[model samples]
Target: MQVSSWRKAAITASFLTLAASTANAAAGPLDPTQGGAGGRIIRVTTLAKDGPGSLKEAVEAKGPRVVVFEVGGNIDLGRDVLTIAEPYLTIAGQTAPSPGITIIRGGIDLKGHDVILSHIRVMTGADGKPHFSDWEADAFSSVAAHHVLVEHCSFLWALDENMSASGPRFTGKTLAEWRANTSHDVVFRDNLAAEGLAFSSHPKGEHSKGSLIHDNATNITFYRNVFAHNVERSPLVKGGAQVLMVNNLIYDPGHRAVHYNLMNLEWTGHPYVTGEITAVGNVMRGGNSTDADLPFLTIGGDGDLKYYGQDNRAVDRFGKALPMFGRYGETKARILQQKAPLRSVTGIPVLPSGEVETSVLQTAGARPWDRAPDDIRVLFFVAEGRGEIIDDEHQVGNGYPKAAETRASFNPAAWNLDTMTPRSGRYPGDQTGPQEKLSPRDAAMRQGGV
Candidate 1:
């Protein structure tokens, strides 16, 4: 089901140019109406998976609600993925005390619009299950959902894609309608997606995908994130998918790193709408477990891909350079060159590729001031050239931390309801900088700061 390659066309109209000083400028390009603005604050008071005062309860509550954490600890979902269908929601994990909320043995299925999630950790670990035995899930997912901005979160130990944006590719009658129906206006920034479990519960035998921007999903942005220890997808863009990938640090890729593929079979009777990826100032460094000679971006399938790549760095284990692009599957499928990205998305904070590694280590992931052990290991491994793509979470350090659940009251007046940012610019229950209480592991990592 392969379609012949097409010639490059003129660049489309711009999306939106974002300014940080604007009344509503989120981390990503989407401006105004960040999430759950002026909505009821739903407090999570329990570490239980679903009962009253639980995260699932807060997520499932009807109408627009802002979810804040009263308890800080791990919420075990018993290997089940919690589905989120409510709209206009904001999950403010940063409101928790000390070590913030972490969801273990489960994942988040975000199917809501106008949502924002920040400072949350999700570890969909292999729960001691046999190799390739049972079901698998991603640490976070947004399918057919729009107006999302997921910031400063950590997604780890997933048997599938760590974080993904996807939906029915052929949902509407026309291509424009279809693209609108799929996931759009979504942003993933300042996050860590690492160690997506390879060869574990995924029936696919080897599935450690960083993320997948599925076909027809448009207006997606991945900014200043760390994609570490994942085999591939880091992430893959499919047909008609338009993405702005900027200032991201990709460490220890198994086979691929930013790729675009439009499966002809998936497009069957539908037209082969080309995918576009604007990659700017990203760094890709191979690690111990990386596949040899893996390129930074690869093209496959049958549909032509429109690409605009600038200032991206790709290097092998010893700092030797690697090819920036490759072709596979349908080799004849051409890559259409673009001079610039669409104008729709504007406020691109593209750092110099050389500085991406440092920036990500310092700021990426949930609660960088208090990184989870696994996240600490992942960041250090990226820095020190250690760590590998593993099949199980237990192979590394303690699979999940067991912190005593602590309660705290969230004062909504102290936060900007739109962005969930504290009015005082300082988070609650935090000492000054890296000088605060540091665990031995954290102390060692933060010689200056992690």
Candidate 2:
């Protein structure tokens, strides 16, 4: 068929537009003296003693510009860099992508609007003194801030002293204490977190709310991110509230992987509210003793299991079911294959016959748990590989089929000592398998194996 005139014209227009846009971005930094230039670029370096202040001043003076923190070498946060003063600024790390600008002493207290923190690391207080204590509130606390985007970053090591009071108190109780402050429209995507060190605390009432936490913040999506060696008294979310917890690798040194009160949609006395919480496509592992009352997923009270979905799953570093909750909605979740032979969570390979293998392992690594749980179920996609399901009682080979062909369902009631056999299928043989079983590690691996 002959090409039409409209097609030719459209192709020409698209090429010209792309060329013009490329030219504009490549024009280098704008002249400071020029008016109406709009966007300006600011750089931060550790070479100078006055690096943080100088960079902050430049950002404030530039007015509505992108402030790029360019580190000459790897630098740790001496004190808190970029305090609560500068708001509405897009901050990005340059020397390296994530774990580049490590916040050792203090967190980036976000109280402003439209703040974007990308490719940075928010670490715990590196005081050089090892103690069993949690960090003060949040490493990056956004108190009443709006429209904040935290992408490609890492939040690790928020340990509290074991002797500290259990349960939620108020400010400064523990790192979890900081989450009590309300913040809205916060997006945490493509980030990694580990609960470093060891501390103990208890779960309290309703805390942080209104946030969209996912892995696919950018165009290229990943499977799961790993979080190991973290300890906590109780679960992250309490009471009935809406939060997006997906594609994450969570491990526990002492406490359960996840603990939350299930919202009872039918009960009048229960404070259960209809919330939209999606726990899909994540890998949870770790914790000692398989039969430690660790529900691969647990929800407290008579709450509802509203959309509790887990597919293509794996155990923690210790081979225990990654703990989870929210049974308000009884919709059966998709369980994927765990032994898909191939590595790599995202980017499954295409075969010579034009077939794509989707059973690739997204996350693979050592067990985070000091002791592995007794009953653990690992779900894998058929395209990745075929394997047997093992529990306390027996082992079943080729139990569930791969997502590329068939659908797998999880029965919490029937998930005892019986191993389920995986259904056989075809998968691409080229892609590598997941590097780590934990979500955070798997997530980091996908992004060039951190």
Candidate 3:
């Protein structure tokens, strides 16, 4: 059936609403007596012009509420809407929400203290050019604001039409500086961040920073987040702050995954001296156009960098290993200690077909095998090329005499090679010359010596 984009979107929203309602019902009715004044959930969908006040006003009316910005339809943060203030409130997105509330011509000033913002997209004006407003000094001029939570949101540049030639380039500087000093107790997780500039412009530049648990911000946990197609640098940890970065997929089309540096405390007027950064189980891939000289990750000055179970797919522009700081043992230990067992949060059933089976059986004396458990494995016999088992238990080896010999000796009958077959190999069950001669033990099995 052909479904229009709008219809598809509507269907998705309906499904989400139904799922949420069912979940709430399963949890039972909320007790008004619990958790101080029972957390309130406020929905914001009306346009600011249609209504007199901004979405912030709606949240304030609820009194210590959880304001969910239900962006069912398109809405804009016009020039007049300048600031938002709400204490102990959560600004969440609904129904394909894109940064529910955006600060356009005039930057947004966040005054609400200890605010939790999630699933909301934050972007600049639509103008193609940079609107160089002092975001730190003017836009977000909150004095007492702290403990901000930003998750599952997309932070990017404004549209081209909203930009002007005279405006400042949509460089990542303003935001980077803002995070360096202003925000505290900030957690950014499962969010995508991309710098607007090109690689040539700021080859070694740094972008946003904060309290990342598993990724960028300090005291923040970033798990299963994708950071890809980023220009310039990713997160630059300044000063001596500890950040836990794990299980994140960080790829830079232009630069490295992360850069750690010792803050020139004297020059930058910062108090901290070194950054203690730990990274684990992260997949770091580089862009094709990137210079071969750079490493997938880098650390500067006298800072610590530790990595464990990390996979670096792309070599940096330089031939040297990605610059990582810290002791390897300590980093691995931290990752092991912090690792949590996977749990089913949604109560989804596991499908039998979805699970993959991997097991290997080898003859008595064979070359030591080096293979990951997850990799596919195949059993090959030279006389048959490859054989098939009739059932889970290899009661029947249907191919050549070598196949019968293998099944008899290897008891289990099934063997996983954990190796990719060459394209030129003969078809399964067809006898062919061995690409590489097998070990004496393997040769005996092929000759039916088992």
Candidate 4:
């Protein structure tokens, strides 16, 4: 087959190229994304930060392609961020060997839409930066993106917000234009965002945030995920955002958990647009370093947040009940007791809050069946009701794992290329049976060949 270019139209948002895809993408009007379904397979043969056979190259490749990892272990990014600006890209991180691919000292930044990021691990350390330096990075984020699905990935030790959906609020003029341009139709489901680095790298002191759904970012769903040990912003929605948060476990938020804040200064001349948040069947448990009397959802300045909730649970370390809603800013910033329009738009099923902790720990994060040490440590901490906000990543989990690097060839016959799932219902190093029921510590020890 001849190679083809991934074209982008000047006017149309998603219509880019015409390639002979297995299942044609960009064939019709914008629909829900099927990441790189029709594209050719691009094997990542090296764990180098960038180069012909590296993960960076696969993401930055011109045409639609499914990026599969043959190599596993850490790829030290050396404090750099790999921005995937192309559309129709599928990063098949589950294809890697045991321990899976872990990106260290950096992050994956998304700008283009029509992307699926799954089964990946990104651990962003402080990188030897001073406490109040200007440096910042998200383990995974949509800087300005849409039509994306991020699932079953692990994001931790971020210098700033661990994950975010953000973009230029006003690319054109008027409300419709703002909504069209900003990040929308983005979903973070069955993933993990934990241990955002406090008091490190970011210029502002104490910047351990989870997800920042920026102004005007609409149709955002955070479902069945885990947010732990982050000081704040276990997803803070800004002005004009539409969001659905369901069945997520939030632990050890220092002064905040799930919050809605529309800072006035950030809006400046723009008209204040109301944001709506539907938080249902979510669990928030206070842990060490959690602020006294922390609310599950805190409403802040400038804009009123239309809110609705059902069966949400918030408790202290001792299992004492906590308030579901609180206000920190203006008396005008109201939490309207009404169901958000987004609640009806999304179809994410909600589990009871009581089951969230167990469900998240079992399935959240990259390669959950073969967790790396840091993931095990974080999940273990959450399970034991122990953990704290940290200024640096090395404060936990013996830092990064010291596993010897491993690699293998791409055996096309073993995987379903369209879905990037193994044909045998098992990944490269998946160990089922008794190991499936092992404790996190035992799993870690076993993973280390001890």
Sort every candidate by TM-score, greatest first.
1, 4, 2, 3
Colliding residue pairs in candidate 1: 14-343, 14-344, 15-343, 15-344, 16-344
lDDT per residue, candidate 2, 234-298, as tens digits?
A: 22434333344445544432344444443334234433332234454555444442234344454
**Error in Å for residue 178 of model 4:** 0.9
Any idea what lDDT model 4 has?
0.80
lDDT of 3 by residue, 125-162 (tens): 22222233222111122232345544444443312101
Give TM per candidate: 0.89, 0.48, 0.48, 0.88
Candidate 4: the clashing residue pairs are none
Off by over 4 Å in 3: 1-37, 49-53, 59-62, 69-71, 78-85, 95-112, 125-145, 158-182, 198-218, 265-272, 301-450
lDDT of each: 0.80, 0.34, 0.33, 0.80
Compared with the true structure, model 3 gives a TM-score of 0.48
Segments of candidate 2 deviating more than 4 angstroms: 1-38, 47-62, 74-82, 95-99, 126-137, 160-181, 200-224, 232-235, 262-274, 287-293, 301-305, 310-450
Predicted candidate 4 versus true structure: per-residue lDDT over 1-450, tens digit per residue: 211121111012221221111121223222357888878899998889998889988998887888888788889898899999999988888888877898988998899989988888888888779977867988888976989988878899898789899888777789888988989999887788999998887987888999999999998988778999998998899998999887789999998998998888888988899999988888999999898889999998878888888889999998999998898865588888884444663433445677667656766777755777777778888888988989886786467667678988879898667666666655667644312346678878988956
Clashes of 1: 5
The candidate scoring highest on TM-score is 1
- Of candidate 2, the 10-residue stretch with the lowest lDDT total is 366-375
Error of 2 at 408 (Å): 52
